[model samples]
Target: MDIVFTVLILLLAVSVSGIAIRLLPFSLPLPLVQIAIGAFLAWPALGLHVTFDPDIFMMLFIPPLLFADGWRIPKREFYMARRSILMLALGLVFMTVLAVGYFVHALVPAISLPVAFALAAVLSPTDAVALSGIVGKGKIPGRLMHILEGEALMNDASGLVALKFAIAAAMTGVFSLRDASISFVIIALGGLLVGAAVSWLFSFASTHLLNLNEEGDPAPGVVMTLLIPFAAYLIAERFELSGILAAVAAGMMMNYTSVANAGPASTRIRAGTTWSMIEFVFNGMVFILLGLQFPHILGRALLDAHETSDVQVGLLIGYIAAVAVALYAMRFVWVWLLRWFASRGATKHGVANAVPGLRTATVTTVAGVRGAVTLAGVLSLPEVLKNGAPLPGRDLAIFIASGVILVSLLVAVVTLPFLLHGWRKHKDPHAAEETLARTMAAQAAIRAIDDVHETESADLDESAAAYAADVTARVMDLYRRRLASLDDEQESRDLARRAESLEFTMKLAAMRAERKTLLALRNSRTINDETLNKLMREVDLSETALTARRK
Candidate 1:
């Protein structure tokens, strides 16, 4: 009890420090900072000790973290990057396995091919959460960041799938390409079908049976969204299917079916808030847990490292370095190939949005830093081998993986800031300044118009005065919103720009409706031709005013 309390206090202090540092102007890698703090606590004099249970760790951490990532991923952006995302998520994992496995076997002959493959498969999964927590706080482009996030979300399931196969081959002394291929297909396909069906059914029920308005209470809707991924995953896994694929499919389905169908205001905001909290707690716990376990893992590995004969400590380090470098290089190659493929799609449309550019590709490639899932798979390996023998080089493998993680941590912490710094320096600085000025000008213009309307409204007839007051109120509201957004002038300008586009679209639709109504009125002789002509002129003038403003 005392130990638990002490650990909790330590976590609280570290978390507070992390938040405080972030609150400052300068940025640092939050995970690396937390890791350092935990490590410092674990130093002999501080004496922070806690029991480590892998099962407890997974049970407590994995589902919420995975679900939150799945939930928070923007549905639209994910779909936009879906083509490259799928290739990176599925095809890239296979490529990584073969590349890392081939290299490891060729470089380290003492380690059996299957074991090396296990290492490869385990290390292939990247931690998007970790990368985002570290690097994403900076000025990376939204499109590029989304692509990396998409890849991270999907590749997790892919890496796990590969790990399962590699572990099976290592344990059973069997490596059948045909069987593995068939199993992967079946599991992947089956999981997707199950997830899609379940997601569709749930969404349908929520929309139809529930007397839910888009602006109504969101707690129930939020809870339902939280449950879908895990339920989908477990149900599919029970049927001998891919739980990971099921989770992904369910997430995609929820985004496409439920979230997209939701109205823009309260429903979306509520769902976003719920997912945000889940993401925060889950991410905090995962990093803290990872840091806490490191000392114990290192101690155990050191004890067993001395007995390992298959690979020396030096060779293991070399292998880890080689794998890390190879994995990074492979990511660059794969991303380039995917960009080429995605570009073909974009060329068909001739738009920037449809195709990601070179900078986006580079950022995506570098963002793939391996984290928890990799360690999970490596540590999950059997401590004892076949025929009553202890697993050869198991400790060495863990140590190598740890070294790789350390390398990855260092690279992510150091390189991410540089990347962010460079991007911020190059990307749209002046545009923001210009936009801010325009938004302020627009707000001032609106305010002036409102003041004139209110003054004129005083002497008007009741109906005219009420109408003028209503218009004035609306104009004032818009100006107020614009003023509220004045802190970030460029961001406000972007909003105004988008709002202007939406306003144009709405006006166009309204003009068409008005034209139809006027034609009907003329045909019915309810309104005269002169009145129709005047209405047409007013609408045309309104259109011109909007067009001039846009210019």
Candidate 2:
């Protein structure tokens, strides 16, 4: 009963947070708002307290979110940005671990090198979700956003893997750079393979065994899709591979699978709606959970430090500030070097204005906001060693990690907007490609309609054939007008667009009338609720389609 009540409260909180953000006088990021709500709920008067379990949190929230990102990210962009993503996700992660690890150890002499490394490892993975929430969609340049998203997707695995080794070293008091390197390779590769294989297997089963291609309820297939990430994550972990990467791989694999495309329209619609809801609820809950934990983590740590000495509290805060700065500095330098190298190569190829810009690098650096994964990884650190002795730096590391997470988020919230102002104000880069696609698709649709018209009219009677020809012309005219609207000639495009606009107005009016009539029938009890709903849905779908095309 308690568990159920807690979940309902969380869900209600998530829903309320969504509404509350819009109601606020000033704009704020959704995650921050959710976190604030969580903190408010955790106040003593409110008495809401939820235990934070790192393992369960990671298992429940991480996989589906990562999978969704992989599925949605443009494959072409991901491939193009592969080099940069790898440089950040793999190279920068290790660099941060080594450089920042040693820096942390030096900064706090009490913390062992292994524990410091673990701290750095957890901090290495940036939160693209948080960055997106802060910046909002279409605010960032498309190419840069893709690279950042790709980096966030891949680095979670690398960072967590590093933390695993660091934890092992701390426990056993033994370390092997060579073995760790080799193991990292095997683990990462194995995870990728396992994830792709699992996705493929699901696709095969859906098509061959489940026969989802045939018309039926798509709920089963949608449910199966929901399970893929968890399955991939658990399976990869069972093999001691990188479950994060596995989940990512499974999501990316979804793009190539026929399961999404081959299914009924209802399936696609339901799956899309289901996933959207899941993403929103899960994302909100994760931040809220962070918010719930933050007050306790920060307050308790600060209180303890204060009890010892006022100086100790300041020292704790100073440690957080120093670590946060070090992370940003390391990230900035690494990103600058990567861009500088790329610029040199571009200049060699005769590309003008190829020098790296300060704004781009700074934006990239600031966008590296530590989030849920960092929190989870840091909290997952073992409290006791093999000898049953307390881990020396575990508590302090958590405090620092928590502080850094808060600081990073605060920094990004403050800095990113000013840096991104007036950035990417130019026309959409993909406009031409989109136009070309629309024109080609319109032409193909015309051809298909014409072919079908001919086949249907071949053996018909004269009157029937005449009616078929008229219907065909009407259908094909829609595509012809669409093509004209996309034409290079301004006058023709204007005329076609005007016609389309007038048609849209009429269709919208007609749909409204249909809806009004259906509602009237339902109100008068002349039509059953089911009948009204069926007709209303048709009207709604038409209006939706019409409005979408106009936009």
- TM-score list, all predictions: 0.70, 0.98
lDDT of each: 0.72, 0.94
Candidate 2 error regions (>4 Å): none
Candidate 1: clashing pairs of residues? none
Residue runs of model 1 more than 4 Å from their true location after superposition:
1-14, 23-26, 44-60, 204-210, 214-218, 257-270, 299-316, 336-364, 419-551
TM-score, candidate number 2: 0.98
Per-residue lDDT tens digits of candidate 2, residues 1-551?
88999899999999999999899999999989988988888887877899999999999999999999999999999999999999999999999999999999999988899999999999999999988988899888999999999999999999999999999999999999999999999999999999999999999999998888888889999999999999999999999999999999999999888888877777787899899999999999999999999989999989998999999999999999999999999999999999999999999999999999999999999999999999999999999999999988889899999999989888889998999987768788899999999999999999999899989999999999999999999999999999999999999999999999999888888889889988998999999999988888788777877887777
**Residue range 1-551, candidate 1, lDDT tens digits:** 89678668655855665686668688667777666666655666766765556445544456557656665677877888887677888888899888888887787776667777878887777787788767654466776777777877777767777777877777778888888888888988898888777778778877776634455676776678778777777788789787666766776676667544664345665677677766665566566656766776665665455578536545555777887898888888888877777678777887665654666666666678777677777887787767777766666667667767768878877776665665544555446877678677877788689679968987999999988888888877766655644545688767765775787789888887988899899999999999999898777767666676555
Q: Compare the candidates by TM-score and give the number of the best one.
A: 2
Model 1 lDDT, full chain set? 0.72
